[model samples]
Target: MKKNLFFALLLTFGAFATSFAQAVNDTVYVTINRLPVKVNPIASRDSVYAGQSVNLTVTNCIGTVNWNNGLTGGSVTINPTTTRYYVAQCTSSAGCVGAKDSVRVVFKSLISPIATSASICFNESTTLTAPSTCTGGTITWSNNSTGGSITVSPTSTTTYTYTCTYTGSGTSNASGNLTVQVKPRPLAPTLVANPASILTGASSTITASNCSGTISWTKPDGTPITTGVSGSSLTITPTATTTYLAYCTTNGCSGPSASQEITVDSPIPSVAFSAPQICQGDPITITASGCSGTYVWSSGQTTPAITVTTTLSNYTVNVLCRTTAGDSAPKKIKFKLN
Candidate 1:
């Protein structure tokens, strides 16, 4: 019985020791090493004009950077003449691996600019247009205007030049020119009227000078005087004051006109009798006034005043005023004899 108890105690102690060691050894402490972070490079700008430069940099990379194009640095400058893509990688000093990063850059180019031509009269306005769109450049006209189109009014024939200044990666200028043709205009003509003043029914002549081309006469309202006006001189019989102007035309262009006026005058006489009644042997005198031209009487007298003796109970005399152009209405006086 004593030997059996000793063996059983020994068995229980071994089991307990085994269980304690297993519970303690089950918990473990270890040191871990993590993989390095990859680097991704970013570009400062995604697009640039031709001949312009851009920068590509790796932000998280604390060490040397390598590009697919064999460039090594934290940042690299890219000058692309055309659209292209770029890639770069970086590694940190702490064994961090860099991620592959790529960016696409677009380049802008310039095209030659062109200008259109036109024909216009002097001092007339017209427009010029550039049909092509400007890329990476600005279009400027010789008149110092900026745009695709511009309007100008020039006095004489002119040559217009347009320039395109490249503001992109390229630094240069493209130029083209066109001419605007202008037609010449004649100078104003001078007009003169011969015998500027005349009596009624008298004809006067008008002449033109300093005319560049065919002369045309018109009234103040621009209506042509007479049909088919073709000469420089015109003979007119005007009853009152009248005005006429002459203009010259050539090559579908006309110049200013000169105007001239001719004056016409008419005269009428006034008469009075010296006595209203006269005896058979008595004499009577008549006087005329208010006329600077010649006077004629019904009794065949051509003087300003006349005297007549008549035996009839009643008598009548009439006088008329005459000018170089024509005669005026008659004036009459009556006399009675006893």
Candidate 2:
């Protein structure tokens, strides 16, 4: 009985000591390492034109900083030709990495600007187009237009200007101007003709006014004059009574000017007469042919043939041909008596 009690006490003491040691070891302590905070990058301009430069900056950055471009810096200047994103990663002195922060840069431009001058005729329309290369902008015209292209018609000369506006971050605008010249259409030409009445095969002077470019003349028969097609003055001869028309042409515009009528008279007639020379104290006879009207000789004879019984010096005779058209100019015949 004494030995069993001793062994039991020893077993209880060992179990209590083991339990206490386990209890003391149950309490735990932990240490934690956290990454540093990331700083967002800032740029001088979020949007920039092509071939332009921008400045980027980062704040609250600690110890070794790594950028996407393999460069370490607090501030940098970048020239971006397109949309780009830039990131910066910073680390603390305790050798902990932080989350990366980034920024975006957009590229744009207004290039190849064109505003050409224009010329148009009166009551005509012309189209105006702004430069098509400009991006991210609204085109506005001086005439209160909001389109890239527009057509305008002006009675007189006019001037126009176009403006391009870009709205948003890094907003920008540009402008260009052009002039449009409007020319008035020429008026009808005035025509004038000399010698209202002309003899057959005779030419008349023709003149025009308020005419420009090419001038042309046409007969009443609608036949155009091929020669002397230019200038404001010309001469033409017609075999019979004819009317003429004048026209002016300029810049693909042509119209009749005025019309003139010229009267052509019939030609004079010719006569053939025979007079025989006689000696003193001899009777002389004269005959006329192709005579269509009454005739009178120098001896007061009203016949086609006249005889002079007594001629001392000279005698004169005249014959005239007349018809409904008109009277001939006149023909004279003289006979010499010896």
Candidate 3:
């Protein structure tokens, strides 16, 4: 009977040891406010500016709540413009375990105002006003004109606009039109010449009145006669027998003032015979005068002076005068051959 009792006691001791080991490995579920608890991560605010701090609140079940950062806190704040995750684990006195839910943090850009269009012209001034909806910000012009309004002076017809930007909070844009009218000075003086008739190689002068700035002349052939002449009067000479036109120009304005037709006539040619009488088969020399070019003889000879070998006969010689000015005329020489 005594031996049986000892064995029973050993069994009881073994059961107790097993129960203690099981208790050490057991997990305790964390409870909050007397209910099975879950801590969904809390964000500080739905919307906030960059660099603003955001708070995240978490609840844990047991022991001390150990954050992934090795910190113990019921709440935390961070400025995260990037993807971030929060991990919290709870420890219990009974070696139990619990974990808070994790969350991701994301960053976004803030809204700001920007300028859309701006321009300026010469001899004119313009004013620009800022848009009203720009929050916590002021207006600034690139031209050093500040405040909600600015002014600029341009030399000509101009357009002025500016970017409306908000410095802080929210931003927006606005634009205004400023018209500057600068009356340009009257266009340069122009001269118009009328058509006329004149002798070849003669010149005619045309004058313009009330003309400002330098004057220029153009020929009928599209050639520029004078580049710039200070006075209103311009003269052009005709070299050949042709119609000529003259135009007066000042600044950007120009018109035909006058035109003239000139005529050039060829003088008569003088003839001289080598001899008053010539025998058959004898060579005779003939000379012509008042001709400017090669001469053509009836005997098929070409020269200013030619020698002819033939029987006595009457012959006529033709002479042509040509000028560099594109002038050409013919003169006839009559002579007797005996």
Candidate 4:
């Protein structure tokens, strides 16, 4: 049984060897002609400004080569706004096309755009615009603004960056930045007058302070006082109690308005004083009426009636009146001594 098993193994081995030899003889080798054409589309520059031209070249191509755009040359000039894809295919003498080869031309942006800088008043709004040359790509800003333009209300000085993306064919991105300077508003103005209250039709010199800009006045009725005014001071004669406001501006920024109220009172009183004739050694009395104020006489007296001894043939007495509103014009009286 051992001898038979050994003979069977020998037979199996012989059969495998014969089949392998037959397979090797039957195998055939075929040659596939790979296209010798190599497409290498190159641009004159990595990036070009908008409205510029670039050259595309395909090298290592033999026989007649056809480009994607029916262009039949190793090198061709092209003006592509964006990244471009070019395919080059070469044909054999039998009009048979080889394996297609392709090239991607990367276009970089030659545009160095500068964002618009703006100056605005505090709490005010302004618009920031990107250069028009960057319109071909989608614009994105560091402030999360999308598009060529955005409105900004910056509370303080801020700088923003904008980026534009060029997609398809070739992919690239460019960025630009600008600064916005926010100027503070002028200090609030203060309105004041020489006297808080005055008689009717009295002129009050209204003045403005704590201002760092030109000022204009407004009447109580909210109408602008166009009385040829261009400074921080103005005088107004109001027939009744009136309030005035001052508006100040600096560098196109406006400050809070300052206001003051003036009270108008009754007109000044018209009063006169008279002196009585008396003996040379007798005291004299002075009297006044038609006025409401503290009366002061030239005889060193402040009462309504002042008595003084006559020391000369004639004595001149002057009386002055003053009230909360103001002082009145002086009145004089003459007395003859006996």
Per lDDT, the best of the predicted structures is 1
User: Which candidate should be chosen as best, given TM-score against the real structure?
Assistant: 4
lDDT of 2 by residue, 174-279 (tens): 6777788877666767877777566567677778888767777887677887664436876777777778788777775566567887766654434443433456
Better candidate number, 1 or 3, judged by TM-score: 1
Summarize candidate 3's per-residue lDDT along 59-149 as a digit string, tens digits. 5454555566556666776766655676766556555556467766655443332223133323334554555543344555555566765
Candidate 2: deviation at residue 320, Å?
Answer: 14
Ranking by lDDT: 1, 4, 2, 3
Per-residue lDDT for 112 in model 4? 37
Clashing residue pairs in candidate 4 (N, C-alpha, C atoms within 3 angstroms): none
Using all chains and alpha carbons, the TM-scores for the candidates as numbered come to: 0.47, 0.42, 0.28, 0.52
Model 2, which residues run further than 4 Å from truth? 1-117, 168-172, 184-188, 196-202, 210-226, 237-338
lDDT of 1 by residue, 1-338 (tens): 99999999999999999999999899778845343346677777676644456778877766778787778887887777878778766666655555677778876554433334466766667777754634546788888988877887888888877776665443546566678877777777887877777777778888888876788888889888974333778888887878988887776677878889887755558877797666687787889986657888998888989998876667688988876546777887766554
Rank the models by TM-score, top first.
Answer: 4, 1, 2, 3
lDDT accuracy of residue 41 in candidate 2: 84
Question: What is the Cα-based TM-score of model 1?
Answer: 0.47
Residue-level lDDT of model 4, residues 119-222, one tens digit each, is 78899877777777664678998889898888888899998888877664455566777888899998778877867777666777888888777897887577
